[model samples]
Target: MNALFKALSHPVRRSIIDMLRKGPMASGDIAAAFDMSWPTITGHLNALKEAGLVSPERDGASIRYRLEISAVEEALAFLLQMTGAGRKDPGDEP
Candidate 1:
């Protein structure tokens, strides 16, 4: 999807997704891993959320973000299709 690609276009956002792969983490914890300000990291998180790549849930006073694996799978499948990978050619023999 357009939104997914747009969100993934930024290195910061990509890194955020990588971090989330481990497990859900508090926003503060995620911000601490980077050198940028908390507000800046928040912007990247917002993009990921808008693209459906991440979901934020309230955890008491803090919010934890979790990766949406289905969205990642959707992107992977699209890439595979575009590259003719994991897809059979119609002319191939059975």
Candidate 2:
């Protein structure tokens, strides 16, 4: 989707997604991993959330962000289609 591509256009947002790949993490923890201010990191997180790439859930007192793998898979499939990487040849046998 357009939103997903836009969100992934930023390196900071991409890093955030990579971090989330291991598992859900608190916003504070994610922010700490970056050199930028908390507010700046929050902006990236917001972009990712808007794109449906990440989801936030209240974990006790803090909010934890979890990666939505389906979004990433959708993007991967799109790219593969563009490159004809996974498509079967018309003449190929089953």
Best TM-score among the predictions, by candidate number: 2
- What lDDT, from 0 to 1, does candidate 2 have? 0.96
- Tell me which residue pairs clash in candidate 2: none
Q: Per-residue lDDT of 2-94 in model 1, one digit per residue for the tens?
A: 999999999999999999999999999999999998889999999999999999999999999999999999999999999989988899888
lDDT of each: 0.96, 0.96
Question: Per-residue CA lDDT of candidate 2, range 34-94, in tens?
Answer: 9998889889999999999999999999999999999999999999999999899999899
Question: What is the model-wide C-alpha lDDT for candidate 1?
Answer: 0.96
Assess the local accuracy of residue 75 in candidate 1 as a C-alpha lDDT between 0 and 100.
Answer: 96
| Residue 38 CA displacement from its true place in model 2, Å | 1.6
